[model samples]
Target: MTTDRVNGIARAWWKEAVAYQIYPRSFMDGNGDGIGDLAGITARLDHLSDLGVDVIWLSPHYDSPDRDNGYDIRDYRAVSEKFGSMEEFDALLAGLHARGMKLLVDLVVNHTSDQHAWFAESRASRDAQKRDWYIWADPAPGGGPPNDWPSFFSTPAWSWDEATGQYYLHLFAPEQPDLNWENPAVRGAVWDLMRFWLDKGVDGFRMDVIPFISKTPGFPPIPEGGTPQKHYAEGPHLHDYLREMRTEVLSQYDVMTVGEGNGLDQAQMRRMVDARRGELDMIFQFDVVEFDRGEGGWPRDWTLPEFKAIFARQAASMDAHGWTTVYLANHDTTRPVSRYGDDAPGWRVPSAKALMTLLLTQVGTPFLYQGDEIGMTNFPFTAIAQFDDIAVRNAWARAQKAGTADEAQFLARLNRTSRDHTRTPMQWDGGPGAGFTSGQPWLVINPNAEAVNVAADRADPKGIYDWTRAMIALRHAEPALVYGGYRDLAPNHPALFAYAREIGEGGLCVVLNMAREPQRFALPRAAEPVMASGADLEGREIRLDGWGACICRWS
Candidate 1:
């Protein structure tokens, strides 16, 4: 019933592969510089190899002004001078491939930094050669934005440029203007940029904000206070653009393509990832990641059932569609340990491992963010000025300007929940600079770095790192954990989360206690525990301790 025991099954490398996502700026700095670089990543390739990951998904390290933390790419064809030189990047790619590992570079083509050469030239004059390379429009006769679209980061989505006497669209931040995908020349340029990286031996691309590429033509205005995203998020021409990209660039190589479909529902997601659809190989859904965000009219109350329902829906959809991608934490979300589990009482390790157990057991490729294996928690930011994320600052300013009764409280929550919390430096060790840098870090390392770090966890056999390794190994060793069919188990178990994955002649069951209190449940008579978050299972009935999880194989 193990993977080795199965017969006549076709295995894809990525299907069985585990991936580690590295936020380059915070991963590790080798030159005593405050920021991490390509050389720093090269130096840590050994660590990634030891962790048994098959691919390293490096977030945007392209040339940028650090606006939106490199999501605002200025130069797609070259590495940022701040990070390192082209030679360093080439060496890093070569090193990864030499070790039999693959690399996935971030593709931020949905938008570009205003400082990009293309944007600069496009904005120089009304009739510039590249004028239509970016979305620009004349202001309404009333001397205001052409539409009533609100930005994702809390401002008017259109920014008026006095020099050009026109308005440009920016979905996220003013510094990142939306690219005009409607222009064939612009699309061809993006394709050329992609080809540039592909020629450099990059195995694949993790397309950022891919759903926003195609907007509704005519710049229709949403009603005031309405969700502008409904009209623009997954616009009409999205499939056309994606299909074109597939034919021109993606299909040219045997590379994996995962699109970040931010606001897609189940039906829409199916159309995006279905093999017959010809859009993308997979998509990163935000439903599960957005669980902690409060619902309308009741923003602060945390609802466990709502979270569970969202997870169930997503898992069911993936199972129905035959493929998907799973992730608990990423560079743009708060650490799973602090957000989903009990970050108090130092129970981070068990909780982190438990969440991983729950996620990886699902029917999808699992993405492990850097430092998650060692139980990294969110970094605390005391002041708004210290926050580097535009979204956080904008939200804080909006709350303050509204003169809300709990303005300070709102800011505090934003600080704790913001993506900036996860962008802090990795906790490598208790040594100076937490072993992430020889100099000051780009952002402060978590205060708990002394207790929870790679070095200490690597030394502890029963640590979170070891637990994650075991879980990953299980995924590789068991057929049910890899190519199996998923079915939710004990849906009404309340404190216990469980699911079953069945592969041809074998099956495996995963169980997790999402709460801090111990829970007892009767396991299927044919099941036997193969791995667990803690050393003891407590009883034959499968009693899970606080924040504990286990995997069982059934014959």
Candidate 2:
């Protein structure tokens, strides 16, 4: 650990890094197999280097049944055959290290595919040697599922196994069975998997659904108004297991670990990622992300106050005790331009640029998802059948059965809420298949790619790519953006969002007009214009253009 201690706590490399998230299957396809492989990823090192990212956080590419993409891991130590061999992954790692960037592989220890050897042997019989490797329970009083707990799928969390006369717990799809982390043997096996990857020169891990690793004793039923996710999130032994992991495997490496902390609150987040806890370096919280999730987890409109409130809570991480991750989009989220910004033809460029300005200037490691640099929008999926995400499919089916909404309403909602929105092929150019694959892509390419693609904006000075590059460079040069004090300038202005970051003698003030009409924000003092998304600035007040954002420096 090259950490500098101050009263014992120290600064870590991850706090100063920007992670570029890549969904392996949709990044690039080098083998012409139509699915993206390690070779394809290796060939794109130049792109990442040009973007000036500090780390490449790749989603899971482990062997699986494709039920939950690669999240349902069949083998933690081995890369999927579809992605390529271990040799290709090694080459990819070397390529990343060669460019002065770290590689963080997905650590999906929370669960494994039902076809995994451990689960197969455990389900064979009640007295099997590995019978406790997964959570299994007998039927409830009515000879049905063990409890009223719901799966991410519409069915019960427990799937009955006739061979064993018991039901196994699957928090997600039936193919993904939750691992019994209470077992010391299971914890040891997980450490082995972590060691396997770490020994191969991989830098770190992005723990998938990490909080779900532990569970409450006695498979409990969901209360009348309670959600099933709470039943497993932040379970009793979660911290104990994480600390064990830290001591056994993580402490041995000079690597960073960030947990996918969905459904976790501010206090829970602090507990999970506290530097002194020996658990994780940081975590990804879903506070602001959930603002748009309405009833039944569908998309809904959000007011500016709600957005500000979420950030205020998230910015609480900037305190001496914690740190947070700032991002607008990822593989599971809709594109920033389409989801958060105005992606209409005329306002697309500035709106995307403005969002980039907001995210990068915040007090956290900026997470840039693939295609975010060039301002990619969501794929306009026409029908539900074209969608392949199991979660989305299950939700739509459940909604249909409950008559919550009709077919048309559900499809419209699915178009906005589906994970498939972000899984489309990358638009390299305005060509067939967006130059993503020579053959057919596993998913549909966004129809708007011809107009909004990397090749189009790579050289344009006013393009989203150039804007992001310039801003990232500014962040590298400015200490205020890295470890500075945060304070909001405009707390309640509906259309205007403004904040300030104070360093020793200088401060960075960011102002934005979220509405379409022009707006003006009164600055605290006269400052020099550092950067602006929608131009037009003068003295103590700057008139922002529609969806415009400006950054100013004062000393």
Candidate 3:
């Protein structure tokens, strides 16, 4: 394909697009029910479109029991009554499509709620037709779980079911039973579900925890105190499963399909997304996002080099391959400004914009979490009782049990890094409920709503929101940015981070100052300033003030 044709195909209107992620229950509520609904999302489609988002990736709002915050899906074909009805969902889709925007719904097929019909039927009797739909095995001779695999949420991966007299496999919470992807019938059923949604006009799917779908057979136990994930995660047949999914469902449509490949490395990722691979359109790699959790997981201390190294490696790996999806904040993470940038007074906006510069200039499709453009910071919760996220609550309890720290201190850390940070109500304005809803919000709105909101920032010419819009526009206007290869420019510069994206004679250099003091750097003679996060640059040497970023055209 020619470059133009490839751009046309890969861009998919949705590819050149910016996608905003909405955590439904916390986005906005139209009915004063303390829960955000499809109607609320429909009502705000205009706001998203106005913000230049070409697609909206709503986190799961399917019929779920909320065990893992809607990730434990009970019905793939139906909308959760708590979120709204199918009719409401249809309206939301219609609204988005009408506004020339696409919608990427969450596809959580790796697991299902324990109450799902298939699971219920499968657990009812060994002779049930769907008995093989979910992974189930007899307990050990001593009557315990079949394996020593630990759940992602810190419990046994296998849960005993008294009614079934067998232990069901759950990679996450006990309430979420993993589907048996090894069974052709199960894969067929899930593919059917995918087609059903595609038929309904969903632009694409953000396949959830897709890497965990296929597990090693035989239900072998992990060696004591070992990471069983190495054995069970991204198992032998994961690529087979994805390829089958592509052949059966994804290939049939001209839509985007990004897999949430939690543990995939560069080689596996290339196989999963390369055009010849026929597996997925793209994959969301966590090498960059996982830095916040640090070495020991979740609460380990981190620094600038640690964060930069991960992102740099991830970016290089993606460029080495065909494509990758990039993101700073998502429903699973805290806001980037709070976690990565200096969120104090005057520093927050520039720091947020610098992060944006870093991501948008990299080689990948950039995903912007809702409210991230406005520099939304993390919310503070004094007590565990205030947190609505199941993962945070579970981690807090685990930390306390491990005697990691006192309740107050642990809860503070939870508040800082919890997924709840992204789940908080969107800050639209300083008005009622941060202009998100007319009534009470499902979760606490960030207290800095007045300082960080769409309305206030949109009015400020130099605000982070406008800077984000400019950054996106720059990417759209420059093919070198969207399609070119990436190279880190000043890899070891103490306070300066720089990279170049080049395509033939077209290319651009992106320079960002990570420090808060003014610094000057020598640039190539061909470099000419095209845009800057703040201030202006000239000649071979340019000075950047505190968290500043500049994009220069190289001809």
Candidate maximizing lDDT: 2
Cα RMSD for candidates in order: 2.8, 1.8, 2.3
Per-candidate Cα lDDT values, in order, are 0.81, 0.84, 0.81
Candidate 1, 337: how far from true, in Å? 0.5
Please provide, for model 2 over 427-525, each residue's C-alpha lDDT reduced to its tens digit, 9 standing for 90 to 100.
888988787888889988888988888889896888999888888888887777877877888778888889987775577898888879999887878
CA shift at 40, candidate 3, in angstroms? 1.3
lDDT of 2 at 242: 90
What tens-digit string does per-residue lDDT give for candidate 1 at 375-407? 888877666777778887777678678876374
**Model 3 poorest 10 in a row by lDDT:** 1-10
- Write the residue-wise lDDT of candidate 3 on 1-555 in tens digits: 123434223444544666778889887787877788889888878777766677789899899889888999888888999888999999999999999888899988888999899998998898999999999899887878886788888778888888779889998999999999889999899889989999999989998988888887786777665565455667889889988988898888878778876766777777788776788877788866665564446466655666666667766665333567789889888888887787998999999999988877776778988888889999977777778877666776786788884777666567667888888888878987888878777788888897789889999998887888888878888877777766777776777887788876568988888879887878765678888875457777777899988888885
Question: In lDDT terms, how accurate is model 2?
Answer: 0.84
Q: Can you list the residue pairs that collide in candidate 1?
A: none
Quote each prediction's TM-score. Answer: 0.94, 0.97, 0.94
Angstrom error of the Cα, residue 273, model 2: value is 1.3
- Predicted structure with the largest TM-score when compared to the true one: 2
Span of ten consecutive residues with least summed lDDT in model 2: 1-10
> After superposing candidate 1, which stretches have Cα over 4 Å from the reference?
1-11, 223-226, 295-299, 319-322, 401-407, 535-540
